[model samples]
Target chain A: MAETVDAGFLVRWLVAVAEAVDREADRLTELDSAIGDADHGANLKRGFASVTETLAKEPPASPGAVLVTAGRQLVSTVGGASGPLYGTLLRRAGKSLGEDGEVTRERLAEALDAGVAAVSQLGGARPGDKTMLDALVPGVEGLRSSYEAARAAAEEGALATVPLRARKGRASYLGGRSVGHQDPGATSSALLLAALADTARTEEA
Target chain B: MSPATGGAAAPVGIVLVSHSAAVAAAVADLARGLAGGGDLAPVLPAGGTPDGDLGTSSELIRRAAKAVDRGAGVALLVDLGSAVLTVKALLAEGDELPEGSRLVDAPFVEGAVAALVTASAGGDLDAVVAAASEAYAYRKE
Candidate 1:
């Protein structure tokens, strides 16, 4: 299987994720409205749309540059928490990718680890806090194991949100009430991880 | 388009209002992630927490408001009921509050990005906030 991920593919994947968010934005917002501010899907959609436009207009020279640019754009353009967090994730990962527009499997792993660390630093949320970290951390870890493992872990993380107490973010305000609902951030994080796994798998074939 | 056409050239910052500290922090991280590095200064104020209770929300809002010290202004995005009330209380109680800071209805992610985009693209704070509010039904990917 190929190990390197080219910048073009990375941009395409980001665009795909953005497109997915746009298409499913209403559902994402509806889910968020239940316990959040009712804007997860909507917010991501707008950010990604801009990301798509920016990437299309002037594609970055390197994978890290692409992600960093996207992250900066999201930070400057996106107003909410997810914007920065996701932006941070991409930016951190991008930073770890180096100047080369392509990433080896090892580089990918390193960049993802950097992203997870950045996310942890920015959010201060650990696993079981019912946040995106739950899904993202496991998803990144799973990449070292196998794509199937990563997919399953991400799915499990998303499902696990239903039983969590939502120790962080908007859903946590509900207190015990947040127990039964899946965290929108975590769910979305899972989707992002799943997309990465999908991309890796498809590219390998 | 030029900044003139987009909106005013207002220096903008982010406001993160969630129900919990972890969520606020996490959301803040999300915003930071989107910003790539520290390109966008994000202000995270979780409305409440399981342990911290909701009483401190007003203080958080006040602190977040202070972070948006630029001449342009700060945009506030809230998550839930008490959180909203707490932010509103802070803004109302402040006699010397900055003219640039105000709460507007914008979704968690969309609003922040819209604000950032508008501001970066040369839109004013108000225009950015207006654009951020479009997070509710923003077009898909």
Candidate 2:
């Protein structure tokens, strides 16, 4: 049953993110090299590595603090558009959770929605813009049903970005040339959601 | 954001944010030099990643804005896309930057020159931002 999750659950989710990003780095970088800058993989890997380190060193009391700390670390470390975009997602969602030690599934869903909205507001992007929001919007929406639904929706959203012309970010500069390439941001966003769903299923403690 | 070093009010401050640390620092130098030296307004560069790589750092931008702030407001000139987003992120942080500091969308070099020159002459924030923005239309043949 979808019940409540604790800070340890969030930490496990982030650790899953670090592992996923590390494993998928080459693929993400390959996608980026096709349409945008080629640093996406390395940037995310570095950011997640730092997140792993910080969460280990000085663990936060609440899930909100964990996310806020990780997000701020990414903002400080990562150095690209992804840094702020992803950072805003975690930070806003964390803020929405409001220092809760354990959060219900419904609350987590709402917080994630807020996080996605913050990303949209920050980047001025929509689903069709071929951005991280492409995955995130649907991912958070599907969380209303189940974790598996969210993961499937996010993967589908990422795949949907392949043919869309980028209307935002550095990829937009490529115009028609961007059509055939899958958006790296969308790809990484799906990875993040997958980490969440996986964490929820296996790492419940 | 203190009011100048001495006396009442000083010229509006300027910050050049570029993806390259060298570019930001050099632009600050170029603008200050062209504006008859940076004796009046505070001109600083917030650029590069934390590791001094080619990317914008919000922490760097925030620190530079704070450093250049002189109670007259800070005018930030960004070089490229991510640089703008980084500043926007810092602005979203709610109090990371001093009050009255704003990111001005203008050509990197020309805007820096115009902004610093206007600021050096003790221009207000509005005037300095106007000068930088107006530099977008500066004719080049």
Candidate 3:
């Protein structure tokens, strides 16, 4: 089982995510530009950077607070479609954190469900929309299944984006042209799931 | 996103240095995806706003600096050239930037990861960003 998360660990966790985004931001944008706005990577980077800034101003007392606050920040800072979607993910997950300072498997599962639901509500897009939802929905489900399972599911979801026609967000503007390209959101979502698996494995040892 | 700045009640502030926001979002997705029920830190980007470029990331640093607390200064990690100059401009622009705030230019990819890993290992934003800056050496090599 994962050890209880402390403030330092939580900070690092958040930072790690930022770093991952930084590394992949260009790729995400490239995928997005192919079918969508091309701003997904940049937009998300900005939103998270803002979240980091906001959090620095008022560091959360617990893990839940941190996620929730970051979520809220993302929603507000990110102007495009993604801001709200990602914002919901963090906000809902944060809520599940409850008053407890630490995170547990059960709590995380519940929080992730809430996050997924929030994304569903915000985007009104289903699993096959060729959006991040494609990756995210499966990712949360995978987390429940097992870290490795979730990672595999997420990867599958990301690849599945290849044939999808965009039904939501900027990519949808492309019509049939969106068919051959993979959804940026789904691709990034898959990466996220994969990263989580990596983190779990790395942390385990 | 929010412009609110620091005080005793603030959180540890973070600086996000990337080529653009799209990349930033990807990182956020990665962060969210990897979240195993832990707290993810707040990070603001030094560049790319739908409205404008934030007029040289220096402004971003200035604003970010004031946004946090005494110990929580802005930490910078950039994606490319001129961003270094931009950060310098921001630092030179005024006294508003907290003494705690400093620029961290690490290899874009490796720096972010190293900083993050360091942060996970119990380093502060300053330390994490610093580690990230060190990773910039890889770019030089």
lDDT of each: 0.70, 0.89, 0.65
What is the CA-based DockQ of model 1? 0.04
- Clashes per model (N, Cα, C within 3 A): 47, 0, 45
lDDT of 1 by residue, A1-205 (tens): 8667788878877887786777778877887888787878866887788898999999988888888778766644443567667777887788778799677766776788898887776666789998888888888787777766777887788788888887777687889888888788887887777777777777878
Candidate 2, residue A194: Cα displacement in angstroms equals 0.2
> For candidate 3, what is the recovered fraction of reference interface contacts?
0.00
Off by over 4 Å in 3: A1-9, B1-50, B53-141
RMSD of 2: 2.2
Error of 3 at A39 (Å): 0.6
The order of the candidates by lDDT, greatest first, is 2, 1, 3
Ranking by TM-score: 2, 1, 3
RMSD of 1: 15.0
Top DockQ prediction, candidate number = 2
Q: Model 3 misses residue A22 by how many Å?
A: 0.5
TM-score of 3: 0.58
Candidate 3 lDDT at A54 equals: 80
lDDT of 2 by residue, B14-115 (tens): 889999999999998888778884465889998888788999888888888989887888899998768877788777887778877888978999999999
List the lowest-lDDT window of 10 residues for candidate 1 chain B.
B1-10
> TM-score: which candidate is best?
2
Q: List the residue pairs that clash in candidate 2.
A: none
